[model samples]
Target: MSAESPPGLDLARLRSRLDADRPGLVTGPLSARLIEGGRSNLTYVVDDGARTWVVRRPPLGHVLPTAHDMVREHTVISALGSTAVPVPPTVLLCTDDAVLGAPFYVMDFVEGTPYRRRDQLDALGADRTRRIAEAMIDTLARLHAVDHTEVGLTDFGRPEGYLERQLRRWGKQLDASRSRDIPGIDTLRERLSARLPNSPAPTIVHGDYRLDNLLVDDTDRVTAVLDWEMSTLGDPLTDIALLVAYTEGEALGDEISSVATAPGFPPVRDLVARYTATSGRDTSAMGWYLGFAFFKLAVILEGIHFRHTQGKTVGEGFDRIGASVAPLVARGNATLEED
Candidate 1:
């Protein structure tokens, strides 16, 4: 492969990489534009001579270790390609730091919009909203149904202590991002750890399953599931619980007040019912998992809040994340106690 002078991640490098690996790869001059709104990673749309591609990489500035594993992200998506799940086709992976100043992966740029705001949800008609919601649940069910052994991911994560490790991991993250002691975080953490639910069998879990992390086509079908940084082998119910926490209940009502009052959005019970019917897993344990997901998200948001306070993140959403911490903790406690 002939190495050209590293261009400023413009058409030159994009074309060069594609040409080197996929000799007949047709593309257009790379016109790059940033896809704004994600708190964790930086995403860009790069159009080559004829086709558009997406490049995902870690955010700028200091990053935590193993936080953004591009290789793992690429691997999981590539593995899912043969499955019933819908995911963007991963085209190339660039591990060399010299290319983009960080490890990154390129995927077939999907032509769809990600719902980032409640307004976007409102604009989508009730029928489309319901279809998209059902699609999300179905996609997640298919994901959890994938056989890890067949996907060459039997060793994807240590499932022996999945819940325990998750509690510890986020607990450590909370400590690292501690700005001030929240009233109930410590107590919630203790209760969550003590009440860790039993696992049936380890299944692939999308750590951050939510409406915003997905892309929907004109038909309201989910075209791709984005942001696999926190995906791992664990109780798949955790994924369902996260979906519930972020979408179904009053928690989401608090996050997006307008949506809570909307007519189309399905309730938490209906979502759980759909998941139970599709996945056929005993969801009686869902309460514990829901609590855990809320606690985990609270810590992650708190981490962002910490970064924002340190001037690491420059924006409005992050600065307000701390406000959700207490509510999230309370929501978690409620889930644990829900009969």
Candidate 2:
């Protein structure tokens, strides 16, 4: 091993672990690069001079450890291997921090596009873009349709009071990152806290479900759902609300996160209707969920911003994360009040 290993990975040590655990998985010298960063765990594309795999690990010096449970992410994905939801095939899940400086998982590298910007969707054209968006929603409904107990996930998460815990958890996270006064943020929290709905029957919830969090293949179908660090047994409608909230927002700062803003993407109402039709669940009371989604995103960006300010954030795109928080908080307050 040289002194030039990447910040979050030690290729030599990784090779040793893979050899000891799985044997003959690597073919040649290993290489890696940070492929995703900012608010969530760090993702990297590591190659063995022949095959490539995606690796996920906690962000460098992340504030919360429980939120980035690599074992839980791997467990849910591995459990869903025989199910309808498309997830990258699991190759390895390593918890021994001595190998990579932290726990991480490796899975087969699936070929697809995350389609995070407007121009990317524009290139796909209106009809194709619409189809991909529909597929994204349909895939989510299908994921919600899976029975956790049958999939051996009966102990994955506590279904009872999931919403209340989320509200309280994200509220504390927001307070932890409060560097400046954010108008209407406290009011938004209060309203969500007061009007919390009795959650629907719990299912597998992808805590942050959005177009960018999914990979679409050439057929415009969702090839794989990435970033399952937040997946758990909880109110599945929360997943729908978060997706709709991200899709329907008019302003999410100056960032080019406009995959949902691309022309011809179906309206959020149509998405909600489609989900309700497919999932056979009542979503008339989703307004508060949408509000909570906005609040959750606001707090997430604030946490990223706080880390960026501390020089602890590892990659690009974090410069504007702080600026995006206030607008999201305001939108959350407005959404709750509108209903």
Candidate 1 C-alpha lDDT tens digits along 13-62: 66676788788775444567666576777777776557877888876664
lDDT of each prediction vs. the true structure?
0.77, 0.85
lDDT score at residue 222, model 1, on the 0-100 scale? 87
Local accuracy of candidate 2 as per-residue lDDT tens digits, 194-292: 998998888999898888888999998888998998888999989999887777664575352677778878888889999999889999988898999
Best by lDDT: 2
Candidate 1 C-alpha error for residue 236, in Å: 0.4
